[model samples]
Target: MKVTRTRLTEDEKKAWRQFCQASHASESEMLKMMIRKVSGSVSHTSARNAEPKSEKVTVRLAPGDFKKMDGRAQEEGYLSRTSWTTAVVLAALYREPVLTNEEVNALRQSCRELGAIGRNLNQVARALNIEFREGDRIKREAIEDLAERIEEHRALVFELLNKNMNRWRQ
Candidate 1:
């Protein structure tokens, strides 16, 4: 890191020392005030989106459901049925545990709904005679989202880093 140093006059030095002392206490008070201000804003925007996934599987569908799920997975975009099912469950299920039970159930229902969606979607894909591996579908979706965010942030960060690199070189 590059930092600049400067000499201060006697009057300025005394003021600077007082400012430093006051800022130390002021920083704490400022932080407390900001925390209070932001505590309300700490919304469940993305964090409280869904509930944490739990194993307690007191409910498992029949083998026929698996078969249907497999077919649906094939239609959606998966190669291996088992892996596809696991991915489906994981993707639609997991979230922060601190959320409410209603929120958790909502997420769970979404998982069930996704399975039904896959079934219906696969039927459509089948009618269209399209064969997409579930793995590829999931991967393609992930890469697309990642590429978008990376491209966005990289553009903003590149100039800052480039300037620092040049300063060091000089």
Candidate 2:
């Protein structure tokens, strides 16, 4: 084995020793023991990290409702209720997310293109004597259609975004 110098805090050193003794048997059994122990505990430790990430949280559901949701989350493979809900809440909070300067400009360009498309679609709708529904209008089935369109455009968007992601030197 190639030896490399590294530093560990006292607590880390003690934890390592205890973890080795309780689970790993000895340092020679890397693949057979330590891997499994670390894999098991890492998830729980990560699950606990979800708490400090949230600010204002409310559990407004009736007594059993939250439990049901937690059960559903667990069934869907999350570690814990706090972890799952924190993720949902954070995602909701950052739904639109932030963009860099270039991204803001790119979004402006995309808006222009989309506006042009919307205008053309509106003209088509008018010619066909059909009501024009805004493409962004929310509908139950529209999510699926929007997802399909997104999948279709993903490669093109990724390429375009990657190319435009850089700074435009003034």
Candidate 3:
């Protein structure tokens, strides 16, 4: 029998112990199962040997964007942006419908923008409510304009969703 020693954070160690307990498997057995799951037909040793060299890549992100990524990485158990980014890239590569980081960022930005628009519409609705209490005839025109804008936004959202439906299905 061969032994492998690797260091893990206390949280990881606790999680591993819990997993082993739940599965009623020894730690070594669980490790072997994990290796098998990732390796498939390839020998773990051979796969490690065949792995490509890691290359340094530089990326520039806005401060706010970097902070968002850092927070997300921590939540997802990644210690650094590089690791998180690499995992995302690798996962996307294996997925049926791969989207570039730029595309994903654009989608996120669109969602934020849409949310802002929705909030503005809600504020307008509140104002319309107040205007209604005052018996203002101008409230009718404002309501129609607001409804038209909402419909336009809804249609745009549906179009975007429809275009990406096939990609999401996979």
Tens-place lDDT digits, model 1, residues 3-53: 335688997765554433322223333344345567865522221124584
- Per-prediction TM-score: 0.20, 0.27, 0.31
- Model 2, 45-81: lDDT tens digits are 3322435754666778887988878775565344446
Instruction: Sort every candidate by lDDT, greatest first.
Output: 3, 2, 1
Error of 1 at 103 (Å): 1.3
Off by over 4 Å in 2: 1-56, 96-170
**Per-model C-alpha RMSD:** 27.2, 19.2, 15.0
User: How much does candidate 2 score in TM-score?
Assistant: 0.27
Backbone clashes in each candidate structure, one number apiece?
5, 0, 0
The window of 10 residues in a row where model 3 has the poorest summed lDDT is 96-105
Worst 10 residues of 1 by lDDT: 95-104
Cα lDDT of all candidates, in order?
0.46, 0.49, 0.60
Off by over 4 Å in 1: 1-97, 130-170
TM-score-superior candidate, 1 or 2: 2
What's the lDDT for candidate 3?
0.60
TM-score of 1: 0.20
Candidate 3 C-alpha error for residue 97, in Å: 7.1
> What's model 3's lDDT at 18?
58
